[model samples]
Target: MSDAASRLAEVETNIAEAARRAGRKAGDVCLIAVSKTHDADAIRPLIAAGQRHFGENRVQEAAAKWPALRGEAPDVTLHLIGQLQSNKAEEAVALFDAIHSVDRSSLVQALAKACDKLGKRPQLFVQVNIGDEEQKGGCAVADLAALLAEAKAAGLAIDGLMAIPPADVEPAPYFALLDELAERHGLPLRSMGMSGDYEKAVMLGATHVRVGTALFGARD
Candidate 1:
């Protein structure tokens, strides 16, 4: 196998083992190969190796990179895994298949309008500031319910919840908290975890793990 394919395989194996330990099927967890910053040359091998879901952090970056790549590999599902600006909602709605960072009502309104105008509704995930971090782009835990209600009122369907725990800490508690919040709010998917702690996240009920470095190697 190519190096990228080998790395992808290892991460998949690790996800499977983590799922088994949690008594969940590996198929239940979607591994999103985060392709942000990496060029098409860096991503093609993983797609060739059967990776269908990928995550990108910026709409502009993805817009520049993915169209041609998708023309070649039409089955790939792109995910927006970063904070989105209200003004860019239309482009984002038209580009991504799933958006993992819907965190506010203004964004909700923008996305709803964009979807209506474009006649397309991508799967949405309400991001939570689970760690209560100030610098992150997520709805405060206290405000999540209201945001969800507002999104629903705006005609946007939210499929899941997403979060990033505080850096340099044990993420288990935060992952568990996100899972519990998802359950309480009737959200079925939980997008949590990244390269370093994805296994822990899988065991803690992460339905989707955004893995980049582990699969693509260190970025430049």
Candidate 2:
């Protein structure tokens, strides 16, 4: 197997083991190969090795890289996993199959308008600032419900909630809190976890783990 394939296998094995320990099946958790910053050349190997779901952080970068690559590999799924600008809503809606960073009512309105304009409704995940940190790119925890309501009022389909915990502190509580929020709001997806703490996220009922370095190695 190629190096990327080998690494991909290892990550999958780790995810499976984590799921088993949590008494859940591995398939319950979706692994999103975070392909931001890395060029299409860096991503093709993983796709060739059967990695379908990939994430990119920027609309411009994703637009630049994915179309041609996707033409060659039509089944690849693209996710927008970063803060989105209101002006770029139409482009994002056109490009990504899922967007994991819908954080505010303004963004919700923009996405709703874009979806209407384009006649497509990509899956939307409401990003919560689980840590309540000042510099983060998510709706404050206290504001999540209102945002969801806003999305609903705007006729946007909200799939679930996504979060990033405070760096270096325990993430389990944050993951648990996000899972609880999803449950209370009747949402289905929980976009939590990263390279270091995905196992913990899985144990606490995360449905999607955004793993980067584990699959792609260290970024530049």
RMSD of 2: 0.7
Residue-wise C-alpha lDDT for candidate 1, range 68-165, written one tens digit per residue: 99999999999999999999999999999999999988999999999999999999999999998888999999999999999989999999999999
Q: lDDT value for candidate 2?
A: 0.94
lDDT of each: 0.96, 0.94
Q: After superposition, how far is residue 31 of candidate 2 from its true place, in Å?
A: 0.6
Error of 1 at 71 (Å): 0.5
TM-score of each: 0.99, 0.98
Determine the C-alpha RMSD for candidate 1 after optimal superposition of all C-alphas: 0.5
